[model samples]
Target: MVQFEAVLFDCDGVLVDSEPITNGVLRQMLGEAGWALSQAECERIFIGKAVRDERARIEQETGQPLTEAWMLAFYVRRDERLRAELKNVAGALEAVIAAHGHTAGRIACASGADKAKVVMQIQMAGMAPYFEDRIFSGHDLQRSKPAPDVYLVAAAHVGVPPARCLVIEDTATGAQAGLAAGATVWGYCPQGHGHAFQGLGVARVFEHMDALTAALNHKTSHGNLI
Candidate 1:
């Protein structure tokens, strides 16, 4: 059994399986600009980062400024192109909604996604109603993952103390954020990212989202510190 008053989730990997779609978006956009990005290159540079951070890396590599004007144009074009490919993280809707529905403490999602995109994805997945007013965008926080700002803000929104919360994260950065916030964290372990959290400080890690769900539910069901 786990002891916590609230649950917080990361959006991209934990709430939705949008990473590959995101990589595809980045790859296509970069490709059009004559920058040939292989799949490995996309994962290395873009995965697990806010778009702006990814853009910064792009700028660093390309040795040119990616202006606001350029970004605005790209967003406009990309949104239309990536619409049909949006998807949810496995057991995301089920896990968060189920826990929120049953537990006394509230459940919320903190995402690196921008607010507009957050609305679009969650609404498209029909997960908005579950979160309703409890959703938080990384833009709203002073810092993104690995800084604890987003998760801290979400915990505050849920009316719980950080120590009393459990965070679900898929990225090493997101898990770091939870740890920085002093929350108990469970990493949604992705294969091949072995030992990513071994020293970063997560309370637990699980390869299966179902396993994470079961653990959280087990803790809740047993009235053990939840």
Candidate 2:
């Protein structure tokens, strides 16, 4: 079994079901900007990514500049919808609790998202207490996911080396970040299909939060190592 000193969580799809809500707002805004796209196409292009990260594509498709003002407006609309529609991912609370115990409180939320949005969603899902001040956001770093900066910060903040941490992520981008940080990453594929994570080097691809909890509670009680 893998012995991990800490557990790092990704906030969006892993803990809170906010991806669809956020992506919906993004799709609508893109459509209004003259770039019509189906919800699946929008998600496929943007999920697990920061909006500004895809500025070129968005601007090219919309025939408009991906301006700061437009991003601000998107954030506003997205947050409004999130506030009204967000909910905890199924079994997320239980998984978090299990991780907390298994790691002896060495748990942190690290995401490639804005800190405000990540915080609000966690609080809204009633998971604020578990993370408290241990939240790290990529917006605060020079680089986001697929770069490893945020996860590196999170592992350090939790007083654990990256190699000794277990990162729970739901996207290949996130898995790349965790692996780049030198942590063991577990992909959370709620749909039970992990094709997206292929070749990402994630240690495991689990379809449910309960599976993660079970792994953390397995005989070694130190999280899945193999």
Candidate 3:
């Protein structure tokens, strides 16, 4: 059995099903600002990145400074759109509940989003109760995903060693963060990103949330090396 003490989850694509909505909004906003990226391109460039980092990249690429007021407005619009459109990823609640059952509540969220946004998304997706007070935001750290800071902090908060945590991630960047933190990372590749995740050295990739319990059970039964 893989000897994990905790399960850490990335919120956006993994649990909330908000990536398409958020990324679509981002694509529209950036297009209006003259970046004009397709939705797929926006996901490629921005998924699992911090908003500040994405904004900085936009500024650098366009040679146009995004004023603080403009950024604030952008966030407001994004949040409003998310509130209206976000839903839980298919089978996400059941998967989380199963994980919690196996780990005795040793589950937490380590997400790239800001804390407020994370909280709002989870609540909207009907997942707030499972992760209340156990959400760790990348915005809290100096460096976010792909840097390992947030994952390490999350493991610390949950009183688990990095090596004893299993992170559920969707994007390569988030998987990299878990790996860098010395955790076993599982990529949930429902969108057919399995090969991309394999390239990142994810321990396993599942294409559906319904497979989560079976995957964990298999690990527990086999004690497989991550």
TM-score of each: 0.87, 0.94, 0.91
Tens digit of per-residue lDDT, candidate 3, span 1-226: 4447899999999998888887887788778777888777888888888667877789976678977887687779889999888888888888788778777788899998888889898888877787778999988989898999988988888899999899999988999999999999998888664887767778887778877865556533222222
Q: After superposing candidate 3 on the true structure, give the runs of residues whose Cα lies further than 4 Å from its correct spot.
A: 1-3, 217-226
Candidate 1: tens digits of C-alpha lDDT, residues 1-226: 6457888878777777777777777787777666788998887766666768776667766666778876777677656655867777666676776567555648888887777776677787788877887788777767776788888888988889999888888778888888899998887765635477778777676765656556656643221112
Q: Please report, in order, the local distance difference test score of every candidate based on alpha carbons.
A: 0.74, 0.89, 0.83
Best by lDDT: 2
Model 2 has an lDDT value of 0.89
Error of model 2, residue 147, in angstroms: 0.4
Q: Report residue 53 deviation for candidate 3 (angstroms).
A: 1.1
lDDT by residue (1-226, candidate 2, tens digit) is: 5457899999999999999999999999899999999998998888888998899998898889999899999999999899888989998998888888889999999998899999999899888888989998998889998899999999888899999999999999999999999999989888877888898888788776777877777743233223
Worst 10 residues of 1 by lDDT: 217-226
Error of 3 at 125 (Å): 1.6
Please state the error at residue 197 of candidate 3 in Å: 1.4
- The best-first sequence of candidates by lDDT reads 2, 3, 1
